[model samples]
Target: MTKTYQIQSYFNFLKRSTNQHGVHSPFVYDLVTKCFYDKKKYPAYQNIKAYRQHLLSNTTTLEITDLGSGSQVFKTTKRSISKMASVAGSNYNDAKLLYRLTHYLQCDSILELGTSLGIATQALALGRPKAALTTIEGCPNISAAAKASFKKFDLKYIDVVTNDFSEAINGLKTNHYDLVYFDGNHQKEATLQYFETLLPTITNDTVFIFDDIYWSKDMTAAWNIIKQHPKVTVTIDTYKFGFVFFRQEQAKEHFTIRL
Candidate 1:
């Protein structure tokens, strides 16, 4: 059986959308055109896409012990890495969006909360070769697998931290991050905590992307709170994800864009 009616509506809404045409801000408009619309054939994209394919084909099993909010697709504690990759990993669209977001920002420093199979992490790294990517994963085995795959892809700037997301984030000294991707914990409390904790680190150009924004009503509530923050100038809701911008030059506005 399926869950979360908001997720259903969210997916449905995402199905009907175009590129950022009416995005009035010059910065966002250029980002949409140059980054989102960029069709340049990068060879690195093939490697990232193939990494997902390899995960989908893998039959070897790894005990999946979740540390954060548990998986919605898995009811049992034990699961195969292949099955987890097939069912629990970020979908192709999200991965591509991650790439676009990173590419748009041209972020020199990135903090990723989850490194599931390194799909999104690779996307972020490949989008910006100069970026220093620090990704946190709770599972050592999963993180090892991801690190090996990153090597295979020749992505060298990634620093995979195998630890609890909250602890790692708290211990971090480098507070300046051009972008932060929140995908480790889907719970409302954890999401809000991370948002508030990282708020002081953001600059006027910082962009924060939250995954599974409509996973539950609680997540929707969290997303609402994030959008209402005083420093948050603009928000774009794409059902599955919510993007927050801290640009001081822009007026506070929200757009439910179909992506």
Candidate 2:
């Protein structure tokens, strides 16, 4: 059922998705042409790929504890580190896009909701080494494993917090982030709750990126609700990811761009 839903959702995305040519907004056009469509082979990309590869080569197994919309790919609590890195972490394309996005946006501070294997977090940090990044993982063991991976790669400018996202966000209210990447809870209610709670932390140029927006019906509906929110000025749905911008200077527009 999940696979079928994703197929249908992807087809819908293809029908609605456009290229930079279709975008009239200068902000979006620049992002599409300069960032999303960029083909440069950045040096940080080497580190990003190596980070995931390092995790993939590890065979260490750990007892798992899922705190969000449970895994779509795993069936057991006992899983190998390599299996998690192979099946659960962000893929090369998405991670590389994240690297480009971090550089393109010149994000000075970033927040990541889920740090599963720290695949995305690695990309975020390597993309902008100077940016202060805080990544929260719900499960202690998983967080520990990811933190270990970070240290192995000698990646800096990261703060890992092991706690439920609700508690984690409570302590971050006074901080403003250039970007927030939501890869934590995929359910509708939790996603919405987090969105509302994080609303106060966004500046006009802040961007929010959501992973697996088409992974489930409820998630897609949550994306719709987020799109219509009063604070959102621009949004881009890339099938694998959804980008939300809170630029008050721009007109409200939703773009579906194939990445």
Candidate 3:
């Protein structure tokens, strides 16, 4: 992470970003007011926090197989569970945002490309307990750890698939998903390839969320290309994540919001 680049990007985002006050799109306005700015302390947050704590305290070690852009913080393949959870897992705020989005949309079928420690997966499951979720993890050891967390948290709605992202995506039987989260691959080519491959599995109502859009210059370039796609009707850039909507009813528009 380049601190100087991030600081510059954030300042640029602030210059164009707005709250609900300036939003003209009705759907986006409602989302901003009802979901993004929602201050309700959901009860599910406690369980999510407890699950995170468990991972933090875990001292078990595992040999990680990283198929995506390797971690910037950790170079070694052998790592402690606590360290992985601390450095690789999604932060509380972003995980909560995922929870809120899942809950608000009431997504019936969700697909997650990455299941690192299952922290975000737990949030998604808690958000919509009835929703069927399939999360993919390339590393068998890490996937096993995530599965244990899911079982420990009683998050039975999620199905953990241990395979590379491309193979996992190819093996998916579902024709369409209500929500798709792209977090496994951070490189530009891989991210774009996944997006194109999954394009056919999306309905007009499908929502796609890309994590770490600003992780690298290439990731940002990929995000820019994705937002400009003909199928994408609306996009929201939150610095940490980039959200793509494919509503036929909505006119093509883009938003950069400060969270």
Candidate 4:
């Protein structure tokens, strides 16, 4: 509980620590401005917002079954979809930020480790129309509901997998992920394992986003390992996410700029 409180405080501090102006690298600057700061409205963002709104409105509950490291927030076996949406789901700001990143990167292939109600998946899909996003959900029921929502939106190139993250990542033949979102396990060991497992899948342009970097001390240790890895050239600590990049051209630098 103390660790959780400390992490929350760090997050509160980070919410005021990083932003777009402090970045000087042309590439990073453009990314922060166009991706993080741009407020120009995209019609697709509205659809994703509506989907989230629907999730918030619905009060239906489901018998949630856990898979892939389980959840820290959910203490009981049964949970409401709307409660989960409002509690566990990514908030609007995070969704919009992801949307902007996908739009800026023009990423075609994306991998999402966790697909809770498909909120982030919808955001990514709406962010880049041409991107083919493969999101994994441990629970079949949740995946089913999310799949139905995707169908309702007529979203193409979005695949939902219901299986262990390890098995799914192992079965992957192609290693062409432009952006990988790690929102599954918050534990240090699992985080490191997933990072190592996905290491070979990364390209020079690959961008990996790890959620809840400060969730626990162990997670922070894992983040340190990820940042110090030889192949990792740059990292950005945006509090909610630790963005790792493997670009050969860029110098090794970590930015904790205020977002």
Candidate 5:
């Protein structure tokens, strides 16, 4: 992690980012008030916690094949499931946020670029039980492990595709997706490539989430370019994840919110 730089950037983000009180846009205000700040616990949270505990308790190791920007915490390809669950997988808070976003938006057809250990995938699957989720993973071993976890949890709606991000995106039968989560490649070129490839797939209500926008300067640049795209109507930057919206009814706006 770029600890020193990120800390500085976070301080800057704090200076610019606002709370719900500062928002004037009705749609954004409603989103922040209703969905982002909702405190009611849903039934799917139990399964999310249980699956996380299951991964944390497993001590099995697998050889990793990283095709994207390599891990920041890991120096070796050999890693244990527990370590990956702790360090590489999505944290509980972000997983819950994703669940809330999926459920709130009523996303029916979802696509995830990365499926590391199936932690986030499980949240998405449980968020909308009837939705069809297709998650792509570059590593065969990791994808297999995620598949096992999905089966163990009886999360039948998720389809784990073992392939590189580009191949998987190109092979998709339809470009339309209700929600798209990008966590596969961290490089600027790859990130922009995937964004452009999926640009046509986005409808007026489509929501795209980019993970780790502050992971690198290049990624931050990629996020900037994405926000500037003519089709993008609104964007919300929460430091860790950046959300893009293509609502035709919305005025073009960008927000940095304290989450």
Candidate 6:
């Protein structure tokens, strides 16, 4: 999880990545141009921005529980909200992109695997405020803090669950999600396990976003294997995030996009 290394890797990705002009598929082209590269200023961005500011200004501290691969930036169990906001939170652009993608997809049922400080979750919530959204967090204190933030931001519509990702996701057997955000566990096997478990819940229009695909070699291998899965008809690797789509009508294709 070295930023310098990740920054160096971006050059290699840039060489391999393309823009809307290079995208042949109609769906992908529209996504790349209209959603991914969209320059429109969304009104919901104000809420997202305000939420982030609060996180940065907040001095409250919480005792964290590491359920997956432990934090690389944080060494101790106790950390300040501002510290997490600065170190663990989604980048501002990424937060905006998540909102845009949610708006673009118009997915009514959304599930988020990791809540952390709920920065990304807040973006997703603002993306489609009315959608039945559920986010899971392994740490109880973190979940409580996120829940409070949702209330502060008037995003009471989001349902925050405090539980391990595996346990929470397994209990949702009957529920199907139109969009799923995978950000909780970065380890390889756990990521794969989550993918398999949720595979049955996806529809032809479902969209899955996997964060930090290049966090480790194990994660890169996981991304490659996920691309080869039969049901995953389309995949877009932006280096930072891997976007998966399951459209039976489309041919299996993978793209590396410069984002």
Reference-based lDDT, each prediction: 0.82, 0.92, 0.90, 0.84, 0.91, 0.91
Q: How much does candidate 4 score in TM-score?
A: 0.93
18-64 per-residue lDDT for model 2 (tens digits): 89989999999999999999998898888888888899899999898
Give the winner by TM-score: 2
Winner of 2 and 6 under lDDT = 2
Stretches of candidate 1 above 4 Å error? 1-4, 11-22, 37-41
Question: Backbone clashes per model, in order?
Answer: 0, 0, 0, 6, 0, 0
Angstrom error of the Cα, residue 117, model 2: value is: 0.5
Query: Which candidate number has the best lDDT?
Result: 2
Please, what are the lDDT tens digits per residue for candidate 3 over residues 129-193? 98999999999999999998888788878999999999889877456899999998899999999
Across 85-135, the per-residue lDDT of candidate 1 in tens digits comes to 778888776677677777767798999999988888988887788799999
User: Per-candidate TM vs. native?
Assistant: 0.90, 0.98, 0.97, 0.93, 0.98, 0.97
Estimate candidate 3's alpha-carbon lDDT, on a 0 to 1 scale: 0.90
Q: Candidate 4 clash total?
A: 6
Query: Which regions of candidate 4 fall more than 4 Å away from where they truly are?
Result: 2-18
TM-score of 1: 0.90
State candidate 6's TM-score. Answer: 0.97
Judging by lDDT, tell me the better candidate of 2 and 3: 2
Q: Give the clash count for model 2.
A: 0
Q: Candidate 6 residues 224-254, lDDT tens each?
A: 9999998899999999899999999999999
